[model samples]
Target chain A: MSNYSLRHLQELEAESIFVIREVFAQFENPAILFSGGKDSIVLTHLAKKAFWPAKIPFPLVHIDTGHNFPETIDFRDKLVENLGARLVVGLVQDSIDQGKVAEETGLNASRNALQTTTLLDTIEANKFDAAMGGARRDEEKARAKERFFSHRDDFGQWDPKNQRPELWNIFNGKKNMGEHFRVFPISNWTEMDVWQYILAENIPLPSLYFAHEREVIERNGTLLAVSDYLNMRGDEVKMTKTVRYRTCGDMPITGAVESNASTLEDIIVEIAATRMTERGTRADDKRSETAMEDRKKQGYF
Target chain B: MTQSGYLDMELLRFTTAGSVDDGKSTLIGRLLYDSKSIFEDQLEAVKGSSQKKGLAHIDLSLLTDGLKDEREQGITIDVAYRYFATPRRKFIIADTPGHIQYTRNMVTGASTANLALILIDARKGVIEQTYRHSYIASLLQIPHIIVCVNKMDLVDYDQERFNEIVKTYEAFASKLDVQDIRFIPISALEGDNVVNRSTKTSWYEGSTLLHTLENIHIGSDYNHLDARFPIQTVIRPHRQEYHDFRGYAGRIDGGVFRPGEEIIVLPSGFKSKIKEIMVGEEKVSEAFPPMSVTMTLDDDIDVSRGDMLAKPNNQPDSTQDLELMMCWLNNRGLNPSSKYILRHTSNEMRTMVKEVIYKLNINSLSKDESDKNIGMNDIFRAKLRTTKAVLKDAYRKNRNTGSLILVDEATNETVAAGMIV
Candidate 1:
């Protein structure tokens, strides 16, 4: 027995780095599913560290829902440029234009679910055998049972019941020609862990996470940002409110919370004292009981 | 903001195995509730689901029963990960079900665990479930085993009953391979001996379950004596600054290695000196097991993934024949005639099952040599013949380097988890 020991964050970082290195070693064409969120940014940072001295051996794939917060897009492009990594954008609008996917009709509709079609199509087009996502198990129930190396059918649908058994640190990436695998390196990380790591590593994030003044409308007790992507036909009055986004997603579905935590330190304090789950404000998850599961079954990230 | 103290906290990963009646959910709920891990939205959602199901109170079991089918079927199918952190340490709970593919789920959960929490109903004493749970924990070589005797309230918090259960378990544990074992009487339902010291168990002198988990000495769990580094990938900058940079990247499976140390590359028998070990951009003096780092050698030698580096005097065996204790994980039985791909660490080789030594009946905790027909959730000792020599160690020696998994090529499914003899 030796006195040398690693902290929890270091251990997690090591595990994540190991998984990323495995992806680079095992898969033929792998890509990071970057959503411009804090999780994805942290994933990219870890991936960079995993193959330092050598560039990250995979492209960063962003499934563009065409309704993203402008800051997310700018930040994504800048980060990609700084990392010297290739960025592949899959547009949901392109799928809609090609009649491959139809847009939702009602006002509450979002391009969130439609990202599945574009994402699968992008994976198929790029011939990516493995798509690394930053989704944590603590986020959703169905995700809680996800294997670190998740297998998807040829149609890209995840069969939660029939996942391959992953043992120890050994991951089996073997799959059929058309079948792809979705690997989550940070499957064990919680939201607090992610925030702590981000702060510890001093990783850069989009400005939307910090508190700022924005015109938003109150709907179902949520502050919806007034943007072109969001509909304003309802009678809800729009007012300027200082809010910060917990999760970065499309404008219509991603809600903001009013807070004074503009810095990462203050955000951590707020998160520590906060009672609600980060995804509680997500309108997409509020749709149904098994919303994430339903979409994940249809090959959603 | 309060930050630096939490950074010093180490991680303690433990798996909890119990049946529905063992009150596993109650124990987990109490732990999370005491630590304030469950968020308000999560509880609200659970409450809403409980109301929708017409339940009078919140079903904490719903929180652990993950996936749509599991909720619908009223049983856990796979291992679900749950997290909670106290001021002293952070914990990851691999909450595995006791039945319905118990072997597969428990093995997956126990593979990375430092401890195993085997729950037993105080009223039931030592049942078959207890035997199965303890057996899996022992077989997986979990460093710590805490037999949590739940439902002590139901047994009137009797010390004699607890002592009797512990004696019965001790009789059974003699057959197991585990060493560090402890007992604690807990009433998860009544929060007795769970978080705080219970007044009912004034006769009990042991620490509470939460205290035990928080203060357990897990620093020595890793193998820091045998330096075994299996290369997962090669790092080549091919850039301007570091043009000739060629490094072997891997997580140390065992022991430690430092610069200027003599090492031998497996299969090639090429001797080289460790020039430097770099974790990301910074060079470290030494590296140990579970730390991912890139090491550069003095001599220019061809070393790639699946190759292992170790001290010349103390090296792992590279052999084509492998004898292992395998737990069949898939629905399909272990087919001796079927060609399977054996994955060990970063290495993969075509392998076939030569023979089945024996199958252990998990229920009775006895070996059944006559029953050679192996199926899912069946743990058996078998001989495997690989197409190429694999660098390996005994499972009890180095868990990272000594274990392997067999993948079914046709269906592309992981069929078995094997621990080397």
Candidate 2:
């Protein structure tokens, strides 16, 4: 008892709760940039703990690419209902329809990069002074240098070279009008930490992360789930296999891993021994060596 | 059994600071690389980068340089945080650069660190830069200081040279306020005493860097004498199950707070008794430093962010002015009259550096009272006046409430690291 301190999950929770409350206290209007993924779900869960007696004083803002998994959307709706928090979605379909953004045309076409424009636009339109995210530094190389409270200029550009010096737990969330900040509450957490925390906290996640029999096609050494978002090519063969997604993104780019790790315990064991990183399955990051860095520079959360 | 392995784990954050080209990055890289924390793909990426540069070997320093531009330039320009864990403890390494220009980065890295790892080149011995690093460590109230005499391979693992350098450092460090100091001689490039024991230097019997980190006596580092919990938010679930539950959610800043203990709120001077302490349904008997728990009082009292709850008899000094040892980090000089935001604990207030008392000559370990201009990479003592009164304690007494950072109002950049004197 005298030698006791917090575990990894508890420390992560404490640090994240501290970050979330700082965002709410510092920014005039802040929102959580939810992507309907496990990371975002964990962020929302931590936010719920941040302001317990009081409702989460901010809304869950999602930048919709209209290429999401239906199960993800279902999970989002149910979780939002359970927490009783407001949801704000910015539709890329509407941006395409309004001629705000043009849809890419190709076999490997994706709205992943286009979501940045919609996200910046949504942030500007809503006047969110601080936008909280679940981006972990250990997830990507560029994010490794990311500050907890990352400030953006009025033009919605991130200057990686000119970031604020974040010391201690003191986050300077000050920004002028038209300029805002992006806060990552779970910046220090790794993929394993997130899963372990989710399991420990009993946070409900989307069913896509669990094993299920689904028709999928193998392309570029990745198992792509068959959905309306993906048009099956002739060379691609579709078959049913027991698989669970290590990451959840749009159905087009997000890949599934061959695994029977359905339960949380199984998932933890699988992740503990897994060789590949969680982002290795996301084709969005593989588009280039610094795809995440490039998108982040243009204000992509 | 797998999830249960993380039942009781503590976190230790430490910083490594030294002069330029003292192999700070290599030491950290070796720690992570040898600990099996570096994944194969990450290692592959680093190896690929090293091969592209046409280096004879894989440059481990490339692992700590996070930014793309920094990697291309082959230097660490900012504070890059790296995480790893043994079964005993989790470690967060604030990998800071040692360049004179990046002094602000060092200050930022050392602000929240519990320990400071000061590296010394075996050839250079105790140079002027080593003194600067030690002074900053002492000023920051970093409880433990581990001075690693690196590059022993270059010195042929000479014990005489190690003894002479240790004596020189001890003579200089005696003037500072550092409480704990330990010395180890290692060759980081040869993987000596970083993660594994070195067979080359059998004379050194101290624990390796990893062993020292895992088994350091950190339980006494926290201030258990005075409990300080700053309320972060109010937690209330309006559902049927927790309809009437009102909890003050916060991270315990200092000391231990137990259930049913008599506590008093600051500024308001209101008193109450702790009704319950809840951390996710497991009712905790007591909460200490760094634990985030919600405490409901027996009586309803007004408490919000920046408000502190502490033992009634043991209270922090409420003051508007403080004397601080500040390390100027930015190229922009200190603004003596201009107001900047000061963040201490959960409280934020506007502050101004009223006077620069004296600047320390890092090389000589002497004070230069004539110098008043605080410039980049300069360590100086100054008086700061804040708009609002802050609950304060000596940095040596309570690290959480005693330290602060001065932010630039225009740029929102943290300009200086302040430790109450």
Q: Supply every candidate's count of residue pairs whose N, Cα or C atoms clash at under 3 angstroms.
A: 0, 6
Question: Each candidate's TM vs. the true structure?
Answer: 0.98, 0.94
lDDT of 1 by residue, A32-114 (tens): 99999999999999999899899989999999999999999999999999989999999999999999989997778889989
> By lDDT, who's the top model here?
1
Model 1, B1-421: lDDT tens digits are 1112247788999999888888998789888877788888888888888899999977776667677787777877788999989978889999999984677899889999999999999988898878888888888889999999999999899999999999999998998898799999998878898898899999999999999999989988999888999999999988999898899999999998999999999989999999999888878888887889999999989999999999999999889999999999988898878999999988999999999999998888678899899899999999999999999999999899889999998888899999999
- Chain A only: TM-score of every candidate? 0.98, 0.98
Cα lDDT for residue B22, candidate 1: 88
What value of lDDT does candidate 2 attain over all alpha carbons?
0.84
In candidate 1, the residue pairs with backbone N, CA or C atoms under 3 Å apart (3 or more residues apart, or in different chains) clash, namely none
Kindly report which residue pairs in candidate 2 clash with one another.
Answer: A52-B235, A52-B236, A53-B235, A53-B236, A54-B236, B104-B329
Looking at candidate 1, what is the lDDT of residue B107?
89
